[model samples]
Target: MTVYKTYTIGVTITGAANGIGPILQNNLGDDLFIPAITTGLTSFTFSTPVLDGAAYSVTQRIRAKAPSQDCSSITPVSGTVNGADVTVSITCVLSTVVPKFAFVTNSAADTVSAFNIDGVSGNLTAATPTPTTASGAVPSAVFVDPTGQFAYVTNKDANSVTVYGINPDSGVLTVIDADGATADFQPSIATGYAPMSIAVHPSGKFAYVANELNLAGGNSISAYSINITSGALTAIDADGATDGNQASIATGVEPYAITIDPLGKFAYVANYASYNVSAYTIDQITGALTPVADSPFAAGSNTHSIVIDPTGKYAYAANGGGDISAYSIGGAGALTQIVCANGVLTTCSGSNYVAGSAPRSIAVDPYTGLYAYVANSGGGVSAFGIDPATGALSAIDADAATPGDNLTIAAGSVPISINVDPSGQFVYVANLFSDNISVYSIGVGGALTPLPTLSLSTGSGPTSVTTTQ
Candidate 1:
């Protein structure tokens, strides 16, 4: 017996010129409908045919308006279409959801390259071939805050930090001055000397900079309280006192790198000249750092970078002496070197893990914390498989011959910095000498493959890279 009776789910959209939707019916499901409206008019209506007595659900597929605008479905959107045509309502409003941008620092050009990143595919769309904003002299490193609201850059020669307000819609960066002064002439905040890298606490309430040298005496960490509203920086009133710089936290000689744990409880610094790691406990409210017990823990020679895992369980340091130093995070944020012997496949082992020459930087996959990548200034990136339980690292595959055979990936000259996209689907490497960025798509079992043309053009001397997603 054939009973051909049908009804439709109608959607009326307000505040938009056109509306397109997907209306799913119980038997004949997943039909596309385009609601049409004349130009300059904001009201529209559309419907798709549905079978009689079939359950239906409707969702907005496209809302023709600014990217920031949003549309939501009203109640009665899903029901059994019995006889007559069913009508539902959709309301359009202004909603902003901007994400996925990449920032790169050019040390020689004194500018930062800004690229808009696609959330689905990690491809980059450059706003300009050249950088749009001018940073301070010798901008060595660039870091984006956790909230993706602002970007901070370190100027080695300028002895300051360049703060930029990130445009939510386009990912364009604009220099921001907290004091309402000129951004081109003066930096947003002053530091001791030669700030190497910057890291913001997990709470997003404070920020710290690793100054390689203090004008007066010992190295210091510049401490600042972050303004939640405007993304501005204000120096914290707290001081390091005896050995600290003026209103800043003090460390050993030439602090080259700094990172806060995922929990926002502890902070760590890698002192390059001192060849050790400095540990500190963060005063959550005051944004102050105090020395942890047995501070200045031993690491490989010439430590250049340090990073804590997303779980806040393990830490890794990239040493210039050609090896990675791994540690387990103690209760108070101190690092204890793990001694996992060879042959432990998944277990953690930081002991005697040799890397390529001049391993300058290291980073863990924040999304999974399952892999780590090292930026070797010698022209390739070393990939490591992180042990989940022990929080140590192991080489991905020792059997593969030559780099790019699945063991390691090749990069351009002087790959000074490396970063993983927020989605953990891609990797970005900044080649300082070659002035290019190498792109790689991560594969199964923690392997990397070239995404496309291998590398993208960058500024004069791209030194640092970071991402938002």
Candidate 2:
């Protein structure tokens, strides 16, 4: 059956005269142009034939010259099409600001939850329609770009990375639809099986994922070049396929997590089964990975997570054996285990702070670069004060000199992942077994005081937490 719909798209220019631009439809090409709107509003009628029950989108744009003679976006930028005749009204406003957001991945529910951080209290408020489908199975890790415009989630069960376009103002995640003109068709990009972790470079040009299960090669890491303007990812391969045809780079056994340094010069992977950290130098222009000298450096037994300091001078690894390993990073991205006399880094003369049962995630303070936190699966979080000169780790609680004084603070059951906000004032933890998130406020000397609540309820089995503010 042939279906036809007649729709009028209305464009209104509030302040400008004779605004010029194009009106775009998702499936249809740019077939109409905005006439001179000397008055406030103008309407154009078109009788388009489309398949019944098909979805389309309509948006409007206008050209202005205050900043430059470029097309400025007017909202509501896109309108929903349901194969029915409808009118879309767009008001062109000049100023709009993007807001900060925090995201958590619910592993068992296979969803992603978003929240807005309270500016003054550092509390998280659930976004309207809080949880959104993560678009893949077992969303294990999530990372937001430095530009704050896009987010990527690694799905362990589905072996794909779901790309989401972040709503600038409302702090929501929407999967990019199958519209090349408006959005991209690649909402979820294929990756190696059992992808565990994701890391975006500080330059915002590259992203890497640690695949836990070996596909064709041994356990591998996937590299991708990020599109700056659109936030789309293109796989980098030597064969030159436009799509993601790059073969995954081999890594140590059971690569659990990956991280990039602040300078964007190197990448690191923590191998759980191999008990080592793999270091690689990242090519600036091409985003290729080259192993550094003695790339798989020895770390604690069953190291699971790694994080680099903001200064790029040191790195830390959390191990399953309830210890955090310290290392001094070289200029060429080599890892040197800090000489420990008695489990201590032995520079300022301190021992490795013993954390909860199994440490899974580690986070560093971005601003001061002196504080670090780890989420221990046993039941709580471990806080530490990092020595800037010798790259040593020290517990922050009262008994600083005592060995195994992890300065542990209570959290919900099975705290699997943790993070600190940009201001360094608050900390968030994702509790897997309890399906809740614990909030804490950082105090003097990295002391954590839990907020007066049990915890924030989340979807099923919240496994990871990340924030941008």
Candidate 3:
């Protein structure tokens, strides 16, 4: 028999822009038979008290009669509430409107997008663009500052970083610093080589970038000191350092992905070339990194992705070689291979087994930490039930269950990445070859049920997908 634990969920909605408060009032009013409306200037009140775990939905409608320059703009909506003693808030902000990729500053396709997220319905409404002082760039990653006052973006092709001041009440963004603004701080030329990823420290004092360095002679990670007031980035110590076994902690061959652990004590990199993973201890005070003993541990062949569990107790790598590797993180930030019960390391400990096929991305459900989804370039995804105590994976249902139309036909082509929403209710896959995204509803048994497929514009080539909360 299996033992299951029950949990309660609580939700609060705030910062409703684009007439979200009125829309939410209407939706919840119909669903719960309660009248709700916007009271004071920007405040929303409920006629009936909301209870914990109660289901609700929100919708926003706005109309601007202006024909030309007399435009109208609605603010981004945000949700904040307590769930299981944890405070979680989701905000929407607007940046540039780019086509073909999963790039959207807030949900808006225009310069300004409304910020509205319904905690009950789990739906989003896109707002019109409202440009501020900030200009547009091809943004690759978005990092919100710890104080929630600002956010930064990595412009890969532009070779620059964009900074914006965040509006707390509306969750909208105004450009604080635009492109080519070098007086604020610039990344070292070497480290700025096609910057692919960015991470902000918990303290909001420092930021890190993973440079893909698509060019001939430059590839490395860079660090920057963030200006809390201006939201600018200034190059920090050892601006551009190669991943070497001696000087810098060497990842396998081509370092494509990087993530810092939850505790902010260690950082891990997935090396695409060396087909391995590198672990490093982070200097909490200085934000410098030193390789751990036995640092570049072997993973499956062509290891391209790594993610730490929410608890910071386990580290997982998705290998292009078609297998997922699980490692037990020691107290000292060292990684020890978690072997199978039979004393072997590379064997299926779970029910859903993945044969050798390029597994490109891995996403773990933050709520349970008991399941993970791996997107394979070959087509399907392998779902693994996690052993929370030992960090081992076992198959849950069966191998690669097709979600939608693919159930009768062949699988979609080359799904590159997978992301589970913060609510842990949906899982999304970015299909590189198909140029589409597949959304699935997660079942209580940790299984995936497919929903309608959403098509992306031609040549969008979405390499990554992240949801803001």
Q: Which candidate comes out best when scored by lDDT?
A: 1
RMSD of 3: 15.3
Poorly placed runs, candidate 2 (over 4 Å): 1-99, 177-184, 214-218, 238-246, 341-353, 398-406
State, as a TM-score between 0 and 1, how close model 1 is to the true structure.
0.74
* Of candidates 3 and 1, the better by lDDT: 1
- Clashing pairs for model 2 are 344-351
Model 2 over residues 204-258: C-alpha lDDT tens digits? 6678889997556338888787775677777765112234556677789989999
Q: Model-by-model lDDT, in order? A: 0.74, 0.72, 0.53
Displacement of the residue 323 alpha carbon in candidate 2, Å:
0.6
lDDT for each residue of candidate 1 in 87-173, tens digit (9 for 90 to 100): 766556544333378899989989998998766667777854444689999998888875578889988888788889888777788
- Residue range 180-229, candidate 3, lDDT tens digits: 33765333222356555566764455677666654532245666666555
Score candidate 1 by lDDT.
Answer: 0.74
Residue 33 deviation, candidate 1, in Å? 44
Candidate achieving the largest TM-score: 1
- Worst lDDT window (10 residues) for model 1? 18-27
